[model samples]
Target: MSRLAQFAVFGHPIAHSLSPQIHQAFAQQFGIALQYRTIDAAPDAFADAVRRFFAQEDGRGANVTLPHKHAAFALADERSQAATRAGTANVLTRLADGRLAAHNTDGAAMVRDLTDRHDLDLRGHDALLLGAGGAARAVAWSLFEAGVSTLTIVNRSPEAADALADAIGEPARVHTRYWDDLGHIGSFDLVVNATSAGTLGQSLTLPFSLIGSRAACYDLGYGPSAFGFLAWARAAGARYAHDGLGMLVEQAADAFQLWHGRRPDTGPVYQSLSTRSS
Candidate 1:
């Protein structure tokens, strides 16, 4: 048998990631044999770990998550426009010449999941993005591209939110507010939770006033980490409440296509995982 292609996801606290299963499902669709592993590396060890992994001849590509996304972008020899725009990369592909290329699939995938899967129209919607970390940075531009009229960013650290807004370079359409000001900022048509509170087993304690009568609330975290925000949104009477599972699957599909030159159907995989998560 020919050697199976090697791929992996790099992140801290990686045991909870569904990347391996998601990618394996994609590979099965094409009768492609591949192995996807999870490498838990702290910030200090990330670059070295990636170097070691790609040193292997079969190391075809890698999916970067959480804290490692920006690191992966820096480590890459080249970057896609999406990566450059986001200032981070979630997917890394190994080129024929042995150099790694970085791509950011997070924003595009989230947009697809919202517009295609959930039928949420982002055009002209006033969106509120909570958190200004890597996750927020990755998807902010895409929200604008999807035609949101305005984006209000809030983070625990006001400076961080300001930095993200400045990076977006849209002083008119993009604005920042202190985390404590969420309650006073008024309601939004679309609310997104991009905070790590969920992953860290904490709650945002968001005010009910943030949800408009017809607002759609989405959390960038999935599984157990998403429960708190989803529950809050539901209690606040959000018109639509969704976890990031769909986005996760969509992003993985993009990464799969990037690595394999074929796009796998994500419906079955997403439904299967949804059942498991439920």
Candidate 2:
């Protein structure tokens, strides 16, 4: 048998990431041997860590996460359209010529999870996005590309939120809302929580009025981290609510395809994770 394809995900505080499990499961479906690991590297050391990983004879690629997306974008010799649009890179691959190529799979994964798995089409829908960090940056442009009628971003700091909206560059469709003005903004067809608060064991503490009685809710978090927002969605009378597990699976599948040239069946992987989590 051929040697295992070596891969890893680089992030700060990566100990809790599910990327290794997700990628390994994807590899099993294709009968492709692979070793996936996680590396915790802060911004200052991120570039060096990436260099060391790719230096390995068999080191193929890595997933970029949390505080490293923008750095990864800078490290890439080339970038996919998605990465360019997002101004970030969550998927990085070692090219044939030894150059690093970057791609942002977060948005594609999210759009697929919503439209294909959940049957939620964002077209002509107004969405309220929470948070203005890397997670938000990687997926906001994709939301617009997926045909969201409008995207209103809110963050604790208005300046950060405004920066993201400005970068997305569609004033007609993308706008920023200050946290204080949240009460005044009208309801939305969809509300997406992309904040890292859940990861930190903190709750968003958002008012229930943000969601229209008929709106759907999605939190870009999974497992226990997703519980807070999801519970709030239900308590607030959302028509539908789901966590980001499906989005995670879909995004990992995109990265896997980039490395192996085959997309594994995500349904089985998603079901397995759900069952295990439950």
Evaluated with lDDT, which candidate comes out highest?
1
Q: With candidate 1 superimposed using the best TM-score fit, by how many Å does residue 145's alpha carbon deviate from the native?
A: 0.5
Could you say which candidate leads in TM-score? 1
Candidate 1: clashing residue pairs, number: 0
Give per-residue lDDT, candidate 1, residue 28.
92
Candidate 2 lDDT, tens digit per residue, 1-278? 77777899998889988899999888888788789999999889999989988986567999988878999999999999888877889999999999999999888788799999999888998999998877787778878889989999999988988999999889999999888887778898899999999888997888878888679899888988899999999998899899999998998999998899998899988998889898
The per-residue C-alpha lDDT of model 2 at residue 172 equals 94
Report the Cα RMSD per candidate. 1.2, 1.7
How well does candidate 2 score on lDDT at residue 245? Answer: 95
True-structure lDDT of candidate 2? 0.89
The TM-scores of all predictions, comma-separated, are 0.97, 0.94
The reply for model 1, stretches above 4 Å from the true place, is: none
lDDT of each: 0.92, 0.89
